[model samples]
Target: MSEDYQLVGSGLTVCEHDAPVEGPVVWLDSPSAVLEFVAAGDVSEKIVLARGGTTTFLTPALTAGVKGVMTLQGAPESHLGILSREYGIPCLMSVAFERGVKSSRGETIPPDGAILRLDVSTHPEGRVFIANGNGHLDVAEPAEVDAEAAAQAEQLRALMASYRGELPKGSAGDRQIRARLRTGVVSTSDENVRRDLAGGEVSDYLSYAGWNLWDLIAARQTEGESGLIPRQEYETVAFVQQWSTYARWYARIVEAIGVDGVIELGSLPRREIGTKVNHVHVWATLCPLFGRAIATELGLEDASARPEDLDALIQFGRRLQHGLWGGGPGFVASRGYAAPVLEASWLERFRDEERRLDDPDELSAFRRFNATTELCGFLLHYDCRAGLCDTGPYPLPDGGFLLVRDHFLHEPGYEWASVIDDLPHCVTEAMFFRPDEDVSIAINDIATTFAQPANYLKHLSGAVVYARDRWDTPVSEVRRLDEAEMARIAHRCDEAMLGLYQRIGDQSVDERIADGVKVYTRDMMMPYARAAGVWDEMVAAGFDELSDLARDAYPALTGGAAQQVLGAVFLMGQGLVPAEGLPPAPEVGPEALPVLHEIAIKGSCPDVDGDAEALEAAGLVVATAAGLMLTEAGHARHDELLAAQRESVDLGRLAAAYERFLAVNGPMKSLSARAGSAGEDERFDLVGQAAELVERVEPALRRTADVLPRFAGYLPRLQEAIRRVEEDDWSYLTSPSVDSVHTVWMECHEDYLQTLGRSREAEGSY
Candidate 1:
């Protein structure tokens, strides 16, 4: 057939199959468009185009209904890519149009009602052709789920539905814990919130924490506090019900997957889970010994001045009598599920009737983990810091541990949390370092040291865990530390903490720390403070150290101000930051174009007064209450520079780099997703994967940087993030607020796309 058609555009095909599909392009650029399209019904011939890969949530209802999907952004690693693959839909990502008429949606497209054909026979690249023929293609029916898989799914769902446990009561302690969890939730972006929504049962972990805390709080009180007490009581019952639900779900998974699955699941990662469980467990196991210690410390033995507080404290011992056995949150959150499940033949080896503190193994492991565990007192802002003092029977070369008994709550800290001191020399050495000889740091949330020292010696400087490696190391070994040995270990811990801040000098460290702090403040603390009704008080207190932290987070702006400037610039780039009653933008010429480029990249031309003035004079930037933000003209100018920059790039070489990048991209993303729910040991392994990924992608990044020097910044940034992970600052792995490994990796990916003059939509990444 001599078909008369034009090759107008092409994209990366999501699926590797041969199927040609034809449909009219329907741009779903907004939520209303999605709603309207879904309402239209029977959209079997409409191929929907969206700007982002994450638009899957919006299009889930439309996915089965549509003929095909063509996204402007996102790669095969994207959620939409995964969904389309699952549905066996013909999807193309990052389509680039060579020539086309502008549509009402502001993107180039073929004429209205024009039929476009997607030829996806090729492995990677899919071709687009405009052919003169009636648009008729048979819609493929949805695939049927396998009978066994369907039954398994049903079984899981049934377990989820059968929970009817009692809820725990609420207290001031519960409120404190909730505040921290809420901060984490509120600090995240809207995009992440949507991801959590898509995550289904996994997101319910937060709910379990909330309800369980309330129960604990209520249990602490001697008598109910009327309205508050009743509410706590109801919430406690609901909490127990949720706990029951989670327990059933976990137990069923264990039963189906067996002991192997249980080992993979490991312990829960949340600090709060361990803290809450340890509190109840320790009180239950050694209340007489610990209760007397606490009474003496709080001076409550005589019960003179604070008899009510003492009585309430004593009530906790009785209220939380159920020892930290198999029914706590840890059971539901962990792999073993509950004690009953442990009795199964496959898991019988894991069962321990001597699981309480009296058992040496249980006691040792508990101290190793919970020594630094802390909590805010009943209603106080400062930490109660009531956890065990230190973790070790850590043996020295002379067969003694360099243990410090005092400050146990904070002494051993994160540095020794996961250290397996008693492992065989060879096994411990293998666990301490990666195969390539990089020191393998353990996963501990409390360790916040970021970046490695520039002139550094590599060694196992912090806690290290072998989560996957099965080992039995008795905690009963008693060791003594000479003064010299004790001092040596203490020095090592100090060195571990000292990194970029000291090595690179305060300015760069200050700025870098500020960047992380800025993200933490804006995304997490501010939202939390506001939610907790303490924002005003914080502001009144002059932001204290927060002001110092935020001030240097971003690159310094011109006019001697940088407060909220990055946020302002980000908003302006998006065409909004909640502006009102602005003055009209001024007109300018090519004279200010260079200055515009500088301001665009550096955020501000602080050193050059003329450059700053040129940008403002060109109406490219506007001053606001926060700081200087880019104007519409500024964004247009920046885009122009970007286009010009792309013209000089070696497209072939950059494309090669992108292909290489794609090789490691999916693995990194998958690792990150898994790390979200994985235990500390598993996360440590994931970090090892991340380090390997960084090495693998370095050459690709170098090739791109050779073409565009600006691209060079990514490698070091990524390395620094991974290095932070090595030092036990786990947030550097994926935290959006900071220049984390994932963040830098993605930025580098986008830079490559931009340099090659490709739209993220066409590339299928957003």
Candidate 2:
């Protein structure tokens, strides 16, 4: 099974998996123990959690204040779902089977890389395909539910039915889901998860079900974060590497600065003036993560001291960071309800994007629950550390215990210490005052709407698709009750599609939106193979709209026409299904390619006369710049693919083309239309650097990093990096740079042409 399936997708990671654990076998009944278990891993393992009955405290962990130590019992956060799943742990919900899960001597697989090993306690040769696959990632094998363990499973299911929250009627479809669980068939019900899906553990309530939510969020927190700007986790980490020389400079900024008086000294973390004097907002956003780091290093008492005490600040400078980037914001309590499962970046959610986008007219669960984004204060005391909570007696700088702030609406209501000349140092402690009730639905609705669904992806059709399936069934990967349930499932997918459209529409031309669209378009295009023949037909379809191309000269369109005439080929050959009459994937006559070109032409370049002429006239290639990063990412990818074929690409030719790309980009560079900040230009340089880096590192990458050995996670980041190359988003590909991912992909394709010793048009790069 491992040989056949490689689970590839984004968020790939490498963790130092040898971290210590309390022990392997755990009692699911103990909530505190479960919290400890979930708390154990950071970039590596999530406790191999499984359960059948009575996970009472798990709900609380999910609901615990976003800022504190809490965990979920039934499921850790959704992100951990992939970890538990990919690592081969089975979760069953009934004591009859659940209690009988382990032997004192069972083995556990480490959650590093893409490999997973299954260990059987009593039954060694049981099926291991339950959780393996690119699609259907959430399916779990119930040893009891199998024909071999049906009796035990039934007893367990019956017991689970009797134990907790009674199953709701008209809630969702679960039968089709259950049917597939026993067998390997996936119906439409298996696909989506949205709000309609009745059973998402609210982002906050996991603690109630008895798991530690804090450790879960902590694991979610990404390090190497600098300042309060919202940047993608991967981007920020890479960005910080570029800024490594300024560690102490920023640290000094922290030392000399106070929450008041805003004259922005640096261009890096920019400040706006007037009604937009949003500096206060930036400072507060940074406070949470900085506070956590300080508290972790020096006890909270020293950290809580006002800016003047200099003790915590002193503690800060001594911490030898591996690079300039370190902490930024803290646990941002999201309103990520069941709208569509959204992933909270351990970084971005806490950055000041919230204050920037904040509209006074809008209603939000965050504001409803409390007036601001910070949440630990509401969940954890009037002085939470005082008599209420049991964790510590950590000392303060002023010879007193640090107290929790009672009001989440503002910082601790303490006096500010005058740094230069105060007699006594002042300290401000944080507190949370969440009432003893459930705040899940309110919070989730707000955050979910704003969140980029599934870790930085906005309006992810994939998540919505998955959510609808879960919505149809309370438990995952089970079938729908019937056909009507299936219709509802499809409707939900459409609805989610609409929601995504609304979100995407909001960012019609934004870079995150544009890049995400291309990312999605490419992913969505995957199921349908992109043969060159397909492109020619697309152009023909849109041919009449393109004034530059005369229709008859091309005659009927060919797949190449689709490529030449239209920039994109969307839904081409969709008619193949009905026209596919008999046997072997239907040979749609030679005429098919031309039709595809027409369709593509109609779809993409119907009126490129505007942007194309305007930009080309300006000696700038906006379209080309738009695609550089994506293209370069592609170039690296094709090179990897070519190497795997025992046909190494010509590095010298690629380097030559890269140089050409640079020459054409001058004058032709569309400096005005580029995506990011003035600094983003520098960041874009990172893409160009990556292109050059891939060229430089190709030999090593081929030797050490090429692991076509796994599927899915393998080479998926290349998906982004690939598009960067293909699109010539680097500005090199558009005008003169021979180095383009499209050029690279094509050149690498030409290398394959060389390998096969076949003549291909790509050989002569015009």
lDDT of 1 by residue, 1-766 (tens): 1276667778888754565788887766554466567667677897777665542223323333577887666665443554455345678877776655554655665554567788877757897777655344222234377999899656534422221111112222222223323223212232332222222222222233323322322212211121101122222122222211222222333345443333222211111111212222322211122222222222223313333332332222222222222222231112111122111331221121112244454333333221111110100111111221221122234222221111211211122222323211111100011122322111111111111121011222222211111111222222223334333443332232222112212334344333333222222123223323454555465442432212222123212222122112211211111122112234455455445654554453334334554455444565544445566667887677767766777778878878988888888888878877888769878889999999998998898778767678788989999999999998999887677897777667666665566777886765
lDDT against the true structure, per candidate, is 0.40, 0.23
Residues 1-766, model 2: lDDT tens digits: 3455332211211111222121122333333444454455441322232331111122222222111111112222232222222122232111122111233334121122222222222111211111233232322234343674778546444423321121111101121112112221111121211112112211111111111122122222222121111122212122112122122222333444421111222111111111111111221122222222222222222322333222222222212110111222111121111211111231122121222213332212212121111122211111011101111122223232211111111111111111112110111111112222322221120111111121111111110001112111222232212323323432332233223223322332233322322222221111111211232333244311312111121221221232221111111111111122111211222222222222122222222322232222121211232231112222333334334543444544444444443343332234323422435446456455445534543443233223222112212333455466446555433322433433333333333343334454543433
Listed in order, each prediction's TM-score against the native is 0.24, 0.19
Quality of model 2 by C-alpha lDDT: 0.23
Which portions of model 1 miss their true places by more than 4 Å?
1-4, 133-266, 269-766
Compute the lDDT for candidate 1: 0.40
Model 2, runs deviating above 4 Å: 1-18, 29-49, 52-56, 59-766
Q: Candidate 1 — worst ten consecutive residues by lDDT sum? A: 374-383
Report the poorest 10 consecutive residues by lDDT, candidate 2: 457-466
